[model samples]
Target chain A: MEIRKKRRICLVVAYDGTNYQGWQIQQNGNTIEAELNRALSALTKEPIEVSGASRTDSGVHARCNYAVFDTAVRMPGDKFSYALNQRLPEDIRVRKSYEVSPDWHPRKCSSKKTYEYRIFNDEFPDPLCRLYTHFTYTKLDTDRMNTAAGYLIGEHDFKSFCSIHTQTETTVRTITDLSVKKEGSLITIRVTGTGFLYNMVRIIAGTLIEVGNGKYPPEHIKEILQHCDRSCAGPTAPARGLTLVEYEFL
Target chain B: MEIRKKRRICLVVAYDGTNYQGWQIQQNGNTIEAELNRALSALTKEPIEVSGASRTDSGVHARCNYAVFDTAVRMPGDKFSYALNQRLPEDIRVRKSYEVSPDWHPRKCSSKKTYEYRIFNDEFPDPLCRLYTHFTYTKLDTDRMNTAAGYLIGEHDFKSFCSIHTQTETTVRTITDLSVKKEGSLITIRVTGTGFLYNMVRIIAGTLIEVGNGKYPPEHIKEILQHCDRSCAGPTAPARGLTLVEYEFL
Candidate 1:
């Protein structure tokens, strides 16, 4: 019998996600996880199953998402980024890869995740930025959005902002920061938090948009949070506008 | 017998250009001009022919391209923007429309044209900007590129940079301004000129990239210009990275 040594490798992944079903494995659709598995398996000749830090929804892009997998391949940690990049598709890239402790789990570790929801607020849609930004002709008032975003900071039960289809033990999450700003015709809503429930960020974006259009006051965020009902909040923003821009493990 | 009054309307058009063949109409492939004609014909119930100020190549984008057409639709010149936008696809838009002199022609009018060549300079390609930016893993020196761009200013015979396939009476043109700037991972080369030969901006970009990469010194641009041979110039940058940003009738 031959004994093989395994080392856990973590990757900083960035993907377009427009063509992907989602980050997780699914039988019916092509996904980011499946692609990574295929590429990793081909590289190491092992049946590698990688675990993702965050399972981003369909059509949602990410600049930096983490994933960890055990491999017996002798390739050094940092060199995996360069080597895996050659094997991966153009839309998916391994930005950085390194070896991690055998027990260090990406999802189990405490981390601060930052996401940006982009809104193209203009008289006409710009084709250049159409893929990443959600087009809204109704001029958004950033001031109102910022005021509403402020209320969501700190620990709060985000049940109202979560999807009804989500299955989680608790709906409570701590949002460290939330902000809204506009440059030119692009409005960016950036939020950083320790964790998030299903569709929490997007639903929050949708509610803020309502506040921006003057349909609701900034203080309405408090009421929505207090209601603890999904129906109270605005509709979930489109998946295309959301991007996982940063994921830092603490 | 009923007769109609025709007005010459000039439009500021913007398009993504990713899906279109080019700005010019052809026997095959969908073009921006063809789309405009189809939309205008549908609106006016006439076979309307639009004259474009610049014939941008395939896969080239534009924020402000000019086109003029004669219409007898009884709609006000400015109002045509709103009406035409409804008929056009999401990738194309009419930014502004106004009445011009009946005899005025887009191509015949002396105009200053400005173009931008975008390069995404980074270790890995950004999926978000993949469609609009040319990805270059090589680190570029913008200062060197700017130095090279300075030599191209003022009136010069650009025969060396002109494509061999292009036909024109004169190869002399005045470059009003040329600049290279870097923001984050994006490098933009902005060039404004009285007129340009076919693939002029793209070739300039390619040559500047060589300057940026230290393949040639900044002064090499002058030598290339003096040579007045297309073979002396660098390769034409990809059309997807180029955009006709501004066109102003002087």
Candidate 2:
């Protein structure tokens, strides 16, 4: 009897996420993973299920998300991106694909993730930029936001910055960098971390925005982190403004 | 009988232009003018007709498209922007509105117009930027493009760059400035002129792109302009990349 060896393939995906429920499969709505699975199943002539590195929430965009699946198909790994893209919607694209060790698991690997939250600080909303950015009529002070973001770096308990619905065993994470930059009427909050709990990035963005708007001082971030309570933080920023921009596995 | 003098209201309008036919009143399709007329009629309680300064082609965007309409409504001129925005679609917005002299006409006045054509030169198309920018996989030489563009500055007969279907009797126009700038994978062609013939900016962009791609030499623009024939220039670029960025009356 001949045994066919299945190879593990990792794909780097990019999606608009405007019309998708999320990166994960859900019963009620369409998702990036569901479309990917359907396309993979059709291409490989096998029922394929992929494991996503991050299960981003609905309306959250990603420039580079990671996913892996095992397949017995004879097609070249790099060719998967082209083949899958032909069947996928325009909003979702497979940026690249490569072969990985069969034993490699996405969640088990140590990785660095980067997210960017965009804010359009203008008197009126820009119709062209409304989809990807959060609109705020009030002016924002980037210097204050950057000062507030300084306290978030390094290892700390991020429970206050995480959604209460998260089921993570531990809430401690190491933030490598956090920056607030303003250009014209656009403000961007970029954060890089070892790992994040559910809604961590959005919550942090909301807190920083409050600091920028003078509702909270720059020092308030310390108090919020020390409280270790979700209620101590500001409201969660909208998902539309946040984008997963990078995923680097070590 | 009390004579209610009709006042001319000039609007500075902005629109995404992705869904509209153009800035003119079209019989078979929706347009920016049609929407403005509808909103004005509802707001003023009287029939309103507007004349547009530029009848932009389908898929072209505008940051400031000028339009003038006469109405008997007593509402403050600046308040029209707020009132019309409430009734208009999300894709279109009235940036500002003010009362103009009854004799003032948008097209008759001497004005300088600025148009920008954006090209996303990358390995693959970015879905998020698809609506506002034209995507090209070929590498573009900005130096060559800028050199070609330089020949277009100053007054000249733009017959070679004008569309054959234009109804204008004269193709002579004065170009104040023409520049090609590149940032990362994005290339922008910005042109400011006293007046433009139909499809003039788009044709110039296409011709400059050809020069950037090595299809034509930098010195070819001088010969093309001297030819005084439409066929001497490159094809007209797509309307999606063109935007009316500014309109300033002298």
Best by lDDT: 1
Error at A19, model 2, angstroms: 2.0
Total clashes for model 2: 0
**In candidate 2, which residue pairs get closer than 3 Å at backbone N, Cα or C atoms, i.e. clash?**
none
**Candidate 1 per-residue lDDT over residues B116-163, each given as its tens digit:** 999999998886787888989999999999999999999999998888
**Each prediction's DockQ?**
0.67, 0.58
Across residues A96-139, which tens digit of lDDT does each residue of candidate 2 receive?
99999999987999999999999999866777787789988888
Reference-based lDDT, each prediction: 0.93, 0.92
Which candidate leads in DockQ? Answer: 1
TM-score of chain A taken by itself, candidate 2: 0.98
Q: How do the predictions measure up, each by TM-score?
A: 0.96, 0.94
Instruction: Write model 1 residue lDDT over A1-250, tens digit each, in one string.
Output: 7677899999999998889998999988999999999999998999999999999999999999999999888899999888788888888999899999999998888999999999999988887777788989998899999999999999999999999998999999999999999999999999999999999999999999999999999999999999999999999999989999999889
* Candidate 2 deviant stretches above 4 angstroms: A1-4, B1-3
Please count the clashing residue pairs in each candidate, in the order shown. Answer: 0, 0
